[model samples]
Target: MKKRFRSTNPVVVGLATGLYPFLYNYYSNFTLVDSLGQLCFFVAFFLLVPVAINICIKIASKKIPFVAKNYILLLTLSNLVGFASLLTFSILGPKKKIILLVIVLVFLLALLLKKQLKKIIFLQYLLALIVAFQLGFYIINNLNFSTQWKQLPDTILEAKFKKKPNVYIIQPDGYANANMLKKPPYAIDNSAFENFLSENNFKIYPNFRSNYSNTVTSNSSMFAMKHHYYKNPKPSSKEAFGLRKSIAGNNATLSIFNENGYKTSLLIESPYLIVNRPKLGYDYSSIAYNNLSFLSRGFDMNVNVVAEMEKAIVANKDQTNFYFVEKILPGHIPVSKSGSEGKEIERENYIDNLEKANVWLRQMITLITENDPSALVVIVADHGGYVGFNYTGELKRKVKNATLVNSIFAATLAIRWPNNEVPEFDTDLKTNVNLFRILFSYLAQEPTYRNQLEDDGSFLIVSQDVPFGVYEVIDGNGTFVFNKVSF
Candidate 1:
């Protein structure tokens, strides 16, 4: 039999398992040099963790083998633990006692059966597939993001704003549009919110749809004023982080706002992976979560920092020209379909959340107008959230194809001008990409900003090569028109 310590197979096994998840992400993401560099870097980095731990174990016990002998199972185990723990913790994190007990038991077992446990060889072939596919993927696809720094086109910065309005771009995650409120499932009355907006001089564009249903995808494109989705024959998840990096870092929107002397602020409401990496040059920042939440790992943002953000907004009301964005909880998913005032809870049902969001918007409007009446306040939902409602009879029938469920892309989009009036764009305009064009046009007093923007029309909510649905929206007389859409 081959001596386990002398065999090189463990090293191969350790390196492959460690690199799987890291390599799984791509969007024309890497060139040969980039992928190889990252693969080498992450493998070495993951291996070092176990090597260090092994050194401590060796120092503690004189007879303990080095990593070469053991091949350090922890190198692979750590990745397994990390990747597994995310899915585990997401489901079990709330049940701290169960997780703690399992962890303690696992540790105790590891201590007692250290010799026997050395044989954990999990999927030594995973690396083979990863390498083979990564190479093929690299050759097959063209990744747009090179290592070279890209300068925003001169046209983006050419127009200058005369009077910088205090701009507020508020994204309420999963907040469906007016049509959804009237759709099946929880058909709640949105007139109160509409009335509130009308009272405050806001235009409620019920026809509007987000470019993408996913928050990160929508925000990345909205900020850049261009599709951040990578250039590929197919769409893959690998470009996700790269797109997010553009959102979290200095993208075109933030750069233009900053260059034009708008004090920018970022508020992280949703606890997606991207929100945690926000190092943008915002003047005021408010993050509602702590490190524990990230470690716990969930796709939910549980808290609304509205009251906290109010304080930040109040602080700079009079002095500087500002652009602030906060993720206010839109109450897309509800805890219950029914509730009263005092029976309140964090996860209210869709109807309750919508009603409360209406109230919340009213309050925010008053606060903004009182402080800075000339502020350009934009209210947009990241994406529509009526997909789960498709379980019902009416909704089930409305969903005709994979391209789109009737109003899933229909997100609430309302904008308020400083003087309480928004410019009239064609009613068919739905995509958020043209928003900055309008905002920049209005703020900079440059009508050509309208000309510079792409014509507002049907855009695809795609899933790689296939069209999930097309966002072809047209509205009149409270009736909602939708394209055959889904992705």
Candidate 2:
């Protein structure tokens, strides 16, 4: 009988190779199609690399006795290093005991299975798939961000009696309404936020809801003066209008303001702008002051905003400045220092971050008010928090925690326009999109463009992760606005 050919299984090889790309894409929040394509590419590479190495070994040494052993060892070591790196880079600080314990357990398991891991082809493939999927998911979800805003009319006829005002757009990442702050051990205390607002002569919108649950999308919409809905259907071309279009086209609010002759400057705390992607129209952008390190990170959430605002004020002391500032306060993870014991450590850390953020906000506000009392300042959250959800729960959980990731509280969308002109506080109506429209109305002396303002006079908050429900603000109540759409 002819000797049977014994070769590695294609499925095993493909899966093993694909795992790296799959995990990377998933964690990086790649679209479905892109993730799959990456997976195929990685798999092909993994299979081909081994073949190439084997051929080289045969040419160099006729026997090539330990090629398989070397390959297995290489794969195993790479996995160990990759996982270790991931743990190192996770936003969750290393101080958490639970995280440390998990790391220890993972290390022990890796060591225990070292022998089997090297020999079992199927197991190796399975391990690769699991790691790739987990890492990919992490990257993808984190990267999936969005923002929106509506246009004001070309002219505000009511301005004859009202004062023309300067506008300030303040975006606090991961801020939500105080009413829905339900995460345990670190729920937000609106009293402090309220106190800050009242002291600053600010008008707080109790019912304001963000248009989208992300900084980039909501901020883009806010600046662009456009209402954006997440539409999965591919746009006809890259030039399409909407939030998707703005991001795809690299449009920025600075461009619009610059066109209208307002000097524009960005005081952003996040690294989004630093990644060196093309941002629209910033002839004199000053982002250096906020790019300092604190607590060993690239940017210190606690002090960056205050510093950036001060710098902006100094730079635009004489100019009518349209300052776009994104404050990284009270980050989504609310961890209190007092509660850093046992399972409560994560929560405590998150709260600690928020408290630091609040401190920064207070300082920034004081500086702004002192420097430019006539500036129109609007403070709002980019999106709600993603905390305290039972991922296993049927209604709350999905492929990921995307649906349950609503912010802890509605953001404090408070506005202090120039000339002490406070628009009638419509407690019954709220929308971040409308806030942009209203601000532009005051700035441009025009009616809200397109009547783009919703008839319901309420804000609509949507997310791709959470398709079944919409968070709406009406009559000063922050509640879920149910929609029939299912994804």
Candidate 3:
């Protein structure tokens, strides 16, 4: 038996052993403590397990006369097996039937690499450099965020408020606008929900569209009251540089509310936004998933959102409250529907969720009315359902008609003002980017703030398309115009 273990370079072995965890963290945008947890698991699995196995091999080699004196090769082979097993599980999920396939593939790969060992070594070094460069770039990008992050416009914090009504901004994820609901794929009879809002003296903006097609981008723009145009350049496709910070920490809307005498509270049904635990500005928060724990699993459904809201409302009833309740009802389908059968299934699922959303809306409205009847309630959506396409990226090619394109950007915005005190600027509220600007103006009784409101131009990023940049899908005058954004 050969005593030398030249085939397994420790750097290559380490990288192979830790690839799955690294990829997971990379995809998750390097969520702080979660990434740290993954690192810990990597160390234990890659280093500790191999060390223990090597110790056992050493012991066996000494005790048994026939045992191979060279244990380094055995240790290296064990590392390869561990890496292969983990990768196979990560890709194909936990299925016993796939084990034989994984073993066969690993055997074939080893045989091919035996003849081309030098080439394989060169490739491994190259991959290591690539991984290191990516990490370095991400670090540099984050360090520059202070200079690159979009600063909140001065107008938002300059306003003076006289009225201190309890304001509630309830966001239902992926609920299509009233017009789009009646259109194709969705053709939903959402009249019940609309009528309920109407009866409650809510002004439904039928043409209200989102400034951006995706949730993080749309809400970030809405809170900042400005179009970011996805300008915060990311190191990777899955990573977003400043959107979460804008949505949570340095939020202009939250700053305005806090600067005034209002006690702000945020209650979310899922951890999609708060999973990384960005510096939250709210005085009180009830999140569905544990932001602090990396291994935290499962999440409370939208049904529990009202209970949390009720608690928050009761706790801060004496002060002027600004509550943001985000419910993940009628959320966009997880996967893109490529075939006709898949698309039809996705449509049915979307409608089912929509129906569930209606029920939740009524429940939420009832809860609010019973507790605080004179409160200003704004029921809005983050973005449209993307009904024709399950996912937003699918719209790049699937948006063949106007209806499909509109469905991707159209979002619901309905506000029930206290004593029906609708401001003149309310009529001009066409997109969510200008949503808070109009509301703050109404609260401040300062019509001048409306003058500084951002243009109601809706923008979206469509990957795998001809012009791969932010496209202005809807103009300020509620007109559908496809123009690539210059800035």
User: Who wins the lDDT comparison?
Assistant: 3
Ranking by TM-score: 3, 1, 2
lDDT, model 3, position 408? 78
Where model 3 places Cα greater than 4 Å from the true spot, the runs are 1-16, 19-24, 27-78, 81-126, 134-149, 232-239, 288-292, 295-303, 335-341, 398-400, 463-465
Q: Please report the candidate that would top TM-score against the real structure.
A: 3
The all-Cα superposition gives candidate 1 an RMSD in Å to the true structure of 7.2
lDDT of 2 by residue, 1-487 (tens): 1211122332333334334433543343333213233345434444454444434533444345575445444343334433443334333422446556655666666555545543544554566578666655544443333432233344432233133334567777776565545433336565876777777888776646666545555655555555544332221111112343353223444455555656766666654433222333554444442342211222323336567667767876765667667777655642343433433454565567677767777887888888888777878886655455321122222222222433433455777756666645334236565555555445555554335554332233333456433333332243344442322
Ranking by lDDT: 3, 1, 2
lDDT of 1 by residue, 362-469 (tens): 776787777677778888887776445422122323344422443455678888877765556534346766667667777777776566564343233344233533
Q: All predictions: root-mean-square deviation over Cα?
A: 7.2, 8.9, 4.8
lDDT of candidates 1 onward, in order: 0.53, 0.49, 0.70
Error of 3 at 79 (Å): 2.4
List the candidate 2 regions with Cα displacement exceeding 4 Å.
Answer: 1-19, 26-28, 31-166, 176-196, 213-217, 224-227, 232-252, 272-303, 333-354, 384-409, 424-429, 448-450, 455-481, 485-487
lDDT by residue (tens digit), candidate 3, 82-164: 55665554444344568567766765666544444445445544654676677666666643344233465556686778888
Lowest lDDT block of 10, candidate 3: 294-303
Model 1 scores a TM of 0.70
